[model samples]
Target: MSQLTTHILDTSAGIPAPGIAVTLFVLQEKEWLQLAAGITNSDGRVNNLWEEGSSLPHGLYKLHFDTQEYFERNFTASFFPFVEIAFYINSHAHYHVPLLLSPFAYSTYRGS
Candidate 1:
């Protein structure tokens, strides 16, 4: 079955974006319903956002990153108030979404 996971890296600091808040949501008919939310660990990873053995339905999903709070705590300024990523899940494999972020820019891609 399909599984969901995520990781965050702070490019500006050249380290993992620890303690950052992340929220996962599934898009329904006309609204986005929250599925799970958690803060990143020291390694900046939420490897199991969903319950183990649970499978997600194939559709569009979103991940919200609380960049502002993370930056403020470290005495940094960020251009993007928040970061949101929308992606499609289409198989019974693990989806690893990794965020590489700086103060003014960020990038993400499907990871292994």
Candidate 2:
């Protein structure tokens, strides 16, 4: 299994926000380097953002979620075009980043 994974839930519709583009990045010095990209499945999950059984160097990381396109596809008005969650990885522990989203607002926490 990958050490990193993510999912998104649309609070407004009470369903997984599928088909949204997501990008993973790691901070090196002052630049954000793209690591991998995946789209949300029907369950709003991307479980292979990083290679399985491999270790990631301790650093700052980010996940960029494309929200505007998701809302447009569903014909809804959204306040934020996208959401970026930046977090630090200091150990080799499993990381789960989850997004709780609405058209007008969103929140994320460091999940298990």
- C-alpha RMSD of each candidate structure in angstroms: 1.5, 0.6
For model 2, state the Cα shift of residue 12 in Å.
0.6
State which candidate has the highest TM-score: 2
Task: List clash counts for every candidate, in order.
Answer: 0, 0
Candidate 1 local lDDT, 6-110, one digit each (tens):
899999889999998899998999799999998899999987788879888899999999889999999998898789999998877889899999999999999
Off by over 4 Å in 2: none
lDDT of 2 by residue, 1-112 (tens): 7899999999999999999999999999899999999999999998888999998899999999999999999999989999999999999999999999999999999888
Q: Candidate 1: where is the Cα deviation over 4 Å?
A: none
TM-score of each: 0.95, 0.98
